[model samples]
Structure formats: structure tokens, C-alpha cells
Target: MAKSITQEFVKGLWDEIPPFRLVLGLCPVLAVTKSVENGLGMGMAVVFVLVCSNMLVSLLRNIIPSKVRIACFIVIIATFVIVVELLMQAYTYSLFLKLGIFIPLIVVNCVVLGRAEAFAYKNGVVASIADGLGICVGFTLSLTALGALREVFGSGTFLGMSVFGPSFQPFTFMVEAPGAFVCLGLMLCMMNLAGNK
Candidate 1:
């Protein structure tokens, strides 16, 4: 049975949330999530690339030869990745620099490539778009949440505004690599617990 467009979109928010549920795209989820700004910026760039790439791949699916489909899909994804990179560099140079190589790494991100190959290449344009939006939004939300958790405990701020008293002692560990891992693990555990309910 085929899913409705709404179902496709809704599943991504929870059932198939890329980082949390699917456990895909952990590199950016772990690396750039030190602050909400980095996570959100990375997420927005991915939203643009994934949605655009999915649309293009779906539109060109029939014409793309089966033998060259993967290559063709990479080319499609890479084009959008480049567009995202250029746009990021121009408008948000500082954030772009902070994200660094991770921005370009979206071309190879399994989330984008997997959707293109698995969904977009086999689905209608509208369904593909829905899938892209749903998955990207879920990813953005996950990143932002993780970033917020880290930022608040690690830095005592949310997007740079202090959320606690001046005397509050930041955990300090929450902003480091180990802290990211611990936070992600705790989140994963919590999500599992919630899903079980």
C-alpha cells in the first residue's frame, strides 16, 4: 500500500527522524551541534539541498539510465550542495566557516543521498518533495534540540542569550566532543523510552 503525502511527511518527524530514529547523518549531528546557531544553519542548508535535489531526481528519474542512476543522483545532489555552499559563503560567512567542511559534506550525507536513491528515484515529484521536507524538518528539529540542550547546560545560553543567572556554572563538558556524545546517547535513550510509552 502506498502512503498518503501527509503520511510520508509525518513519518519523517518521528518514525524516521534521520539522526535519532534512522541513526543517519551523525557526523553533523555530533560535530556542529555545539550551539543552536550551527545546528540550525547546517539544518537549513540541508533542507535546501535535500528538497531541491529530491525534486530534480524525481523529475529526471525516468530519463536517468539504471546503470548510471547512482552517478546521476550524485551529480544532482552535488549541484545543490554547491549551490548551498555558495549561498552560505555569501550570506553567512562566519557560520559557514564554523561549519567548515561539513557544509560540503552534505553531498555525501547518507540522508540526502539515501532519500534521492531510495525515495525520489522511485516516487512522484510531489511525494518526493514531501519526503524531503519531512525528513529535513525532522533533522533540523533534532539538531536544534540537541544544540539547545548542549548550549544551555554547556554555555548557559540559548542562541547566545543567557538563560541562567550569571553565577550559574556551566557544565563545560556539554560543549565538548565527549559532551556531545553523552548528550546524544541520553537523547537516544530518552527517545526510546518515549517511543515505548
Candidate 2:
């Protein structure tokens, strides 16, 4: 039986979310999520790489030998990641600076390889594209949510604007690694509560 394009597509949004659900691609999730802008840039870059790699992988699935599929997929993903890296450097130097090495590290994001192996190889271009988009958006949302929370508490800002009153002081720890973990933990708890309800 063929997989429904809907299932292939929608699963990534929540059921197989890149970070929380699948637990794939945690480095950038943890590293660049200090600010909403950084998280958004990182997420968009991953989306570009993921979509392009999935498309390429789906397009070539039939031609590549199964024995070498993983290597081929990695190569394809790396190519797109490099393209994204150069594009970011050319067009968005500031965001590029914010994203830094995390952009190049897209090459190793498990979400890219996981989708290629799990969905793209077995599915057609359309379904694979949906899967890629869904996962990327899911990832973007997760990172942005975390980044925004951290920014608000840690810097008293929302996406860089000061949200708190002049009398309020910011918490420095929220922008650090421990802060990311704490925020993520709280988000997970909220998600779990929502799920049960």
C-alpha cells in the first residue's frame, strides 16, 4: 500500500517533530536558539537544505544503489548545505554571523538524512517535498518559540525589542545552554499536558 501524502507530510509537524518528537538535530537547536533571530535563520537554512536534499534524494532514489544510499544522501545534503551557507554569506551577512558554523553543520542534521531514508526513498517527489516542508516548519516553530522565550526573559526583549518595563531586570541565564534546556523542558511539559487534555 502507498503512504498517503498527508501522512508523509503531516507527520513531521508534530508526531515526528525534528527536535522534541524525533530528537534529531539538537546541536543547532541548542546552540543558535539564544535569540529568536538566530533561531529563525538557523531554521530557515535547515529548511532550505532539507527540502532541496529531499527533492534530490527522491528524484534519484531509483537510480542509486541501495548499498550506497546513505553516502549518496549525505553528499546531496552536503551540497545543498554549502549552497545555503554561501547564499547566507552573500545575502544576509548579519544573520550569517548570527548563525555562524551552525549553517555548515546542517550537513550533519539527522532530520535531513532521516527523512531521506525514511520517506523520500520510498515516496514520490510530492510527498517527500511535503515531508521536508512540514519538518522544517515544525523545527522552525520549535526553535523560534524557545528563542523568543529566552530572549524575553534573558534580555527583556521580544526579537530584540525591550518588552519589559524599565524597572524590570533581565535574567542572564536564560540565554545560556542551561536556559535552553530549562525552556525546552518546560515546553515539553506543556506539550505533554496538552496531549493529555
The prediction achieving the highest TM-score against the true structure is 1
Residue pairs that clash (backbone atoms under 3 angstroms), model 2: none
Question: Residue 85's C-alpha lDDT in candidate 2?
Answer: 87
- TM-score for each prediction? 0.97, 0.95
Instruction: Assess each prediction's global lDDT (C-alpha) against the native.
Output: 0.95, 0.88
How high is the lDDT of residue 13 in model 1?
97
**How many pairs of residues collide in each model?**
0, 0
lDDT per residue for candidate 2 within 37-67, as digits (tens), equals 9989898898899999999998998999999
Per-residue lDDT for 77-182 in model 1, tens only? 8999999999989999999999999999998899999999889999999999999999999999999999999999999999999999799999999999999999
Tell me the lDDT of model 1 at 115: 94
By summed lDDT, which 10 consecutive residues of candidate 2 come out lowest? 1-10
TM-score of 2: 0.95
